[model samples]
Target: MKFSAVLALSAAVMASAKSVRNHYPVRRESHKKGASSELQSQLPAGMAGFGVSNTQVTEVIIIWTNPGAGAPTININPPAGGAQPPAAAPPPAAPAAPAAPPAAPPAAGPQTHHVTVGGPSGLVFVPDQIKANVGDMVVFTFMSQNHTATQSAFATPCDPLPGGMNSGFMANPNNSVTPPPQVAMQVMVSDPLWFYCAQANHCGKGMTFSINPTAAKTQAMFQSMAIQQKGKGAQSPITGGAPPAANPATPAAPSSPPAAAPPAEAPPAANPAAPAAPPAAGGGVQTGTGQINGNGACVCAVTCTAGSFPAAVQGVGSFGGMAGSLPMNMMEA
Candidate 1:
């Protein structure tokens, strides 16, 4: 009886221990052989536990503690017999912003040279010849009647050179209330330049100017030369700067002398040797041809009386004195 009681007690203790193991499984680090080391490496650091899974016969819920955050759960429900793939790394960070643009250049100073055109004067360019540098600008302000700053060759005083600059005629003839117009010519080249007014007889009247002239060929010399030559106005064929004058007078027709009236026909002369001399100083008559009477009859050679010959034969006349015969007086008839 004592041996049997001891055996029964040993069996009861074994049953209780097996029941406790099945009811509450103990947590343990995985140490099973043939377990995927690659799958273990894919797991995030600080993984705490896993969850139940229907598929993969091994569903796993990752409980990991993120940096500076609470522990979060990541449930991985891969297909049966398959491992869950690891999450992809984040994209590379964006580049920094670009640098600023460069600064602009400084502004230039004001223009120094200037020329006045027709100021107070009826037709003139004041201070016409001005010495200027290559970069200087010359302002031309018209202050009075018509004028132009037309570039010309010094040798050909009033004429404009090909490709030379020209400020077209600015005309304010009556000196109205409006301010005079202005045009500016820049000094691009260092050589001397000649200019003239191209309005009407302004150029002819020696309305000219020059710049940078040599000592030998100064403004005085150019003016003297221009004075001798006729002024080629703006409307000239070469420069063609100005328009034609308005309301130009029409030329009158020439008068013609009046024609003389026909002389009164005289009665046939009694002597046929010499026909009645043609009435003196009236309409001219052919000397060799007989005079025709008012009745359309021709007197031929002083022999045939008036109306004796047909009108068609009237042209035929006496050969005598025919060499000096005058033309028939058609104008008088």
Candidate 2:
């Protein structure tokens, strides 16, 4: 009965040990025959029964089963002490800072600048120089006299630049009360700009202006150069119109004078004539004084009886009376 009771207790303890080994890791150790005997002696007395010898009872065999192929671990029992302090809680997270507002944009609108041109102060741009950015405007108002705001180059301060801006002649006559004429130009770049008055001799008198001038190229220097150039740089602004006509050709002179004409010829001469006859005695007659007949012959006056005069005497004269007688018969009173 004692052996049976011991056997039953051993079975129970073995079952309890198996339960602990299955739940946690364990290590196996072999004991010597002496140690087995010592364990048997520690058991309850009178275990040698039911045909079991004491030596056989002292012989012990232990079987250990391990399901995993892992290294053995050693567990150290905690020292007698109070429980471990709770893990310190992590510091509370700092509150996030408030977000900043977005920044504002810069100004981007265009601006305008006013310039007085040719005022009573003389030929000049009231503010001869200025600084301007792109998209800015420059308006020129003519205050006195005729003038023009014409773009030019630094090299030739008075001459107009090709394809450059030009305000046509704005005439602001003296003592005029009306508003002066205005011309405007928009800045397209930030580069330096040169300008001049295109009026006669105005540029020569140093009427010049500039925009965004550098130290090396200043408005005063440009005006000085313009003055030195005098009217040489002055030019007419192109206002579309007909071109000037070309000059006519000159006439050539004659090489020499012309030739003169010849003189006329004379006529032929006529035959000579004879002398005349004398008058009869006691006859009242006139000689050498005669009249021309229808036949173009001359006849003389004489006194003679109708039948007494000879027929020869009547027809004796050819052009006039005979040598000493009347050529025609005459009667007494």
Question: Each candidate: RMSD to true structure?
Answer: 39.0, 45.4
- In TM-score terms, candidate 1 sits at 0.36
Candidate 1 lDDT by residue in tens digits, 89-195: 21123347459645745535323345666756645666758776554545565656666677666887777655555556655565551444444434545778787
Q: What TM-score, computed on C-alpha atoms, does each candidate reach?
A: 0.36, 0.37
What value does the lDDT take at residue 201 in candidate 1?
Answer: 64
Task: Report clashes for each candidate as comma-separated counts.
Answer: 2, 11
Top of the candidates by TM-score: 2
lDDT (Cα, tens digit) per residue for candidate 2, span 1-333: 699999999999999998998877655445677796786564322221211123443111111111111312111111112222111121123357559855756645555567778767797797899887765656666767778777778989888765566665766678262445554445656778898988888888788989999999988778877876774543223212235666886778866766655555455455455445544555454545555656665655545523344545545655653334333334222
| Model 2 local distance difference test score | 0.59
Best by lDDT: 2
